[model samples]
Target chain A: MSETPLLAVHDLVKHFPLGGGVLSKARAWVRAVDGVSFNVKRGESFGLVGESGCGKTTLGRLILQLIDPTGGSLEFEGQDYTKLSRADMRFMRQRMQIIFQDPYSSLDPRMKVDSIITEPLRATRRVSRAKRREVAVELLERVGLQAVDLDKYPHEFSGGQRQRIGIARALCVRPELIVADEPVSALDVSIQAQIINMMEDLKEDFNLSYIFISHDLSVVEHICDRIAVMYLGAIFELAPTESFSVAPRHPYTRSLLMAVPQPDPHARAKPLSLEGDVPSPIDPPPGCTFHPRCQHTFERCRKERPALVEVTPNHYVACWLHQKGGGKGEPLCE
Target chain B: MEKLLEIDNLSVQFHTPEGVARAVDGVGFDLHRGEILGLVGESGCGKTVTALSILRLISSPPGRIRADRILFEGRNLLDLDAEDLRQIRGQEISMIFQEPLTSLNPVLPIGRQVAEPLMVHRGVTKREAYEEAALWLDHVKIPAARERLNDYPHQLSGGMRQRVMIAMAVVCRPKLLIADEPTTALDVTIQSQILYLILKLKEELGMSVLLITHNLGVVAQMASRVAIMYAGEVVEEAGVMDIFDRPFHPYTQGLLKAMPRLGDRVGRRAGRLNGIAGTVPPLTKVMPGCKFADRCPHMFTLCKEKPPGLFALSDGQHARCWLKDYPERRKAHV
Candidate 1:
């Protein structure tokens, strides 16, 4: 692998304004994604994992520039993407693509399968109509579809087949980096494995890099090389996939891992219970967002927020426990 | 163990324009008193249809449900009148659906919606029902339950709404609780919390539970015994430990192997997940032989010729495969 990342995101921030009217000014902003940074290396799969309303999806969109970030810098292949103009961004679309979560709603019902796969090339006018049709046929076959399915609409296919079409569409332009946001969450368990295996095969065949976003830790652990665990709106742990699974640093990460129910019935259920629900992103807690639910919290966590620091060679954690002489000074509990 | 509910030769079919779809094909199962029976299957495998059939909830214009007997507490539910069924639905058997937002009434307050079951079934006053509802919400671990009573369904978060749904389901103190993918829509932390709440309530109330889910992990954790469904048939029925330790059916083995575990990537490079070879056959495409024969790696000519019946194994475990009937063939193959 190369030292230079295929895509780099730095200090990304996205805030949605709430409760603004003609007579009243804007009250506050919902900090959906706040100061998140990560990188996707060439031919590697990077994962973003978190619970619902934790801004993982928002971070994925920020990288794709689907919705403009309030503040951030995105670099792709040594060029700044956030600084690109409208025309230049349109041209950049061919190199970066997205496969959405829900296959049922992502595809158009009126359009044929062939047209859906070749829409990117059609929009950009990069290829002739005859050539686009030929490319679509090839992509359909590559995704385990037949030529007979080219003329059928999305409604004619099942959930797994529809997801295959979604993948074929994403691969139509031969993008270097693909952002797959919860791609197999909607499918059944067996079908999810099928899609994940197909994705791994395609990545190796095409030499593609991916930014996979999902809430399932096991699925992410199976595919990603590096994983980042997000909380309310910020990342608290980042490490290699093996390290993250075997020796998670952050309390939130450990809790999440213990919370997962294993398939083995003989395995004992560990009671690493959190106190309450996730705090609202609109009115986040004062200091550390996870302090309310964290069991190893201290008085310092209520007054000061910790920054992400390298605890080991490649493992980073944003918790007071890893700080130098941090948790040792405080008492065991409140 | 005493039998709480018994379903014998239950079949459900839908008369669509395309063809007659056999959703559930002669399914049979028994639930013991105060036990949790998990029905595990993928979508279109008839788990949901089987649950809905227990309460006679299927819409009957295009749907038809037939059964030899659906015995509950010495009374056949299939032979009950509408008034009797209505009286038994909320008072003796209640159901919690997958999506709480849609299952709840959007126009009414959460408190009133939860109290409705109590008022209708127990003939309690509105004020008394409301007071009990508040207590129920608090029992489900909802904070400030009394104050949050007047809030509408849309106002509460997904996790809160699910808690409200649980309160509603248990308000009347039913003998059986049918939770169909109850925690599927929630996050991992919230999902564990909900499962724990259900377990706690089940023990306190001593009620039998029918847990319907596609997730093997949830089944392994919550159910004492499980029934594995495939293509509208129960292919394997066994104790949860036996199912995990020694899955006899090919479909069950494929499902367990296909799932990616948490620490599976600790010392190995990322590789393709083991997936089933083919997609599930459509419901309309009925065949006389085993529905899984096409995808089964151990399929023989007998599997394509005739469907196998349940063969008993040790510890009351059963699997529907010809290999169990003819042990010599299995030895020859090995």
Candidate 2:
């Protein structure tokens, strides 16, 4: 725990071009991941949760240098990765692999399971042909897949089995930091638990650190030690899993917890439904991005942006309602 | 206490290259007027299929429905031909899906999309339909609905698109509305907005709702009653509070135990979630016993010998499990 952060991101930003032109241009930038900062401690599972277009997945890709950041500083194991040369970044990537959301699309249908896993070992120059096969089989076994499954294609397997193959490939290079972007979202719910359990066991066995990204809070709550709730490319709340879930400071976080359908009959009577749509990312609202839909929004919220300040000793939140002098939680406006 | 919708001995099958996949089998339930019934299960547990079957929307030869009856407003929808079904589809019963993007027409404006249902089902004139559409949009809490009428589906945010979907579904004031994972695709804040909109509309129209979803948190917040399904069957059905407080079926117990909630001190102390092991069995395979037997912790020989029928419990609670058959094994509480 005392070891330096395995990955530290400072002011990370990613903006996609929204429109095009030849002579004159009418364009806007979709601010996917904007000015976000976080640190993933070694061997710790840090979760990044937001809605579909909230930029969590983009941030994961940016961290692994899979895509270039619009702006940010990235340091991996004290080594500045943002400034790394193309070849250096490529070599460094072997130590920081990623598992995508859709295992069906992520795996090459043309290739066999053995070849898929061996591909990483080959790319990293980590093993010879004979050893790669042996290692691939072992990796498959590690992810609860059988050695015989190595000969099958991605489409040949079921969704759960395909996800296991995807996991086996990610583990082939023995990456210290794995960016698993909604790895279980595509699988069946029953299978989601199995994979999450396997990932937890694998983390302990391999001493791995993960930047797990997802919108499903329940799954994230089960796997992550710490969680960062993001909105419109920026972090709204970051805290320990237990604390964040119980007494969420951010209005958005509270609304999120309230939004999840609990199985209890009593819970359904008075749902705290959020008020409005999220403003477009192409031109996110000024000040607080969430202010537009926030129940506790004030005139101050619309005019001034809040900083991610420490609310508790460890918990951080970026909302005017939770300002040091303001208050602790969202109170209904009279 | 009249039933708004009644499903009897419902079953659905899809023919694939491998074999005939029996999706939903012998599912029966009743939705009281203005009541919100949550149909919950993991993926492939037939929750969505059950909803689709109620609408008689299962695609042709490859897909077949063997339901004894789907009574809506005292009419057996199973016996209705295409024309009769079409008339009732949006007028008597409406449906909303997980992804609003796919459900909406990309080429059409928001106003047109909303108006389509009004014109089709209610036979309103174009101008009248447009006016009605604007009002419905405003009803769903889309600000400046008149000005935003011309905007295409892509122009609005995810939450707005979902609102449009809801507005269209309820435009004709259907007696029963089926929302299949409506908010699962949106962010938590947006999800809340949509759920809130649905709740408001249900109250206003006095329409019953059947919400099909894998998210238990949503069921707790939205459902008045819950039907917990597993591998083509309803394992448990109870009042929402009873399902949460005194879950009788082992599958229901596992699903509850697996979820991570706010202020879950016991969950954190345990460190590991109660993960259900193994993937859902393929629908093509015929099982002689309880579908969840392989995953159940308290499985006995009887569990594997024959599937249990729905056993009545106090307070309208019911569950299908061999454990329930033995009076001694029935615990007084969850």
Candidate 3:
């Protein structure tokens, strides 16, 4: 079960500099992914969840090496893949694919399904034309698409069908880890279930590990083995899905859980616990990024940033309320 | 309770190059004073069209709107003259869209845009309108509302921009508020805040709301009654509790089952999600039967032969299905 973990991320940091000219110095940096660390295990689905601008997407991109990190290391298969050179990383990328949120824009409108699926194989593997066609048809059929659909353009298919094509393309590379960034958020409820079910089945058939990034906690709770709740570009809580749903330690995590309205009409009768919008990333809060909106915030929360620490066996939280000296899961910190 | 808004047999069609696409067909609903009526559907299901049709917002060349009557406060909106409709559009009825950025006047300062309605409708002076706008912004809980008046729409975050949109839409204190997926664009935590804000404002102003969205959870949280739409028709209309606890229509049941509920531990890996097979029937063709017939698990010969009428069930629930028409067919529904 513990074969060096599928992917290990350590203290990752990516700060995008705001607009500046050659004459003027960079005024400030938007801390997109700041000092985040996590691990994805073999054949496991890891979820990254947060609000918009919390940098869940940025973290996904960094982990996939679509973008470079400003600091820290990314270890894949027990090797420091972050240090890999351009060509080496290109080869490494063949093993880690990404499925985008918007199926409309992700696929080239002009390109047919055949080309879209086979393009990755052509770029990486030395496969014959006949072999590529065979693989394309086989993968298309596997993803519940008819072989006839291989010749159709992206626009011909509906949102769910387009997503299937996107999946086929990701599987075309035969990657071990797939980064699905809000893959089903764009689809309807019925279609969302279809795609999520298919992905679950694919995970089993292909022996794949997934880094599922979404703001939807329900989907995350359903699909992920473990989850990391990000707020303002940092993980405030990391726990196994079971532990996460039952005993969420972070104040922000509790607020997020409370905010998600259930389908039952009886649910969510109370007022919203969290207050205010996420502060600007350009200059996030001075102490805990979530302190301003957090209900349990106190003196320590306003002044000192909390690090992710294991208060329970598996549940890790970044809040003074759960700290050792502050007393475990008790009253608000002094 | 008195009915604030009554829509009867409302239909919207688009004259595309290929054929006439009926986006909404025979949609009817009632919104009582100070009540929230949720209109929920997937993409292309015409929930948005129904909301827009109330204000006659559809442009006539490619789009055409038709209805038996759209009564708001005892006046038929369909019979109103252009000038009369204009007077009633933002004053008697107001609407906020999914994308607030495009809806907002990007070039104008937030204060001026928010105050524009006050000057036009209430005939307040510029200074007076601006002061009132600031107060409205504060009502929506925008931080530093007075100081942020000088800022443009681009300056605010997504949540902030949505708040600005809300401030502008309800600043005149309209009798009816049509929010088409108001919180769909915002994050989870912010979504609850916005929903809470909408609820608060509705209570304070004694306004009826027509909330349109694809999310059942949000509908369950906000709406007192819900109307499920599919293929341009209202498939099911019931109290929120009835819709959640016992959905009569097959489509409504499918939507509820398909949604991944928070804290539902039923997700063991590769676990099948009860997704409704087949996609939403395209509006390109006018089929002569139940739109959901192809996807319904309990499909019968009658379902394909004739479109079912809305059968009035006990406890104020109505469902458009052959299953509801015959007790024998209904036995298969459960």
Candidate number with greatest lDDT: 1
lDDT of 3 by residue, B118-202 (tens): 8988998999999999999998988889999999999888888998999899999999999999988888888888898899999
lDDT of 3 by residue, A178-257 (tens): 99999999999899999999999999899999999999999998899899999989999999998888778788888899
Rate residue B121 of model 1 by lDDT: 89
Question: RMSD (Cα, Å) of candidate 1?
Answer: 2.2
* TM-score list, all predictions: 0.97, 0.91, 0.96
- Judging by DockQ, tell me the better candidate of 2 and 3: 3
Which candidate order results from sorting by DockQ in descending order? 1, 3, 2
User: Who is ahead in lDDT, 2 or 3?
Assistant: 3
lDDT (10s digit) by residue, model 2, range B1-334: 8898989999999999989899998999999998999999987889898988887788978899997788888899988999999999899899999998888999989899889988898788999999999999998888899999999998887888898899989899999999999988777756766777788888999999999988887888888899999989999999988888888998998888776564554244535566677667889988999998898877778888898999998879999988876756544433
Which candidate model has the greater DockQ, 1 or 2?
Answer: 1
- The positional error of residue B117 in candidate 3, measured at the CA in angstroms, is 1.8
For candidate 1, lDDT tens digit of each residue in A1-334?
Answer: 3577899888889999899988887799999998888778899899999999999999888888999999979999868899788888978988989999999999999999989999988876678888988998899999989988999999999888999999999998889999999999998888899999999989989889999999999999999999999998899999999889888989999889988889988885964477578999999997788999998888878878888888887888988878886755632211
lDDT score of model 1? 0.90
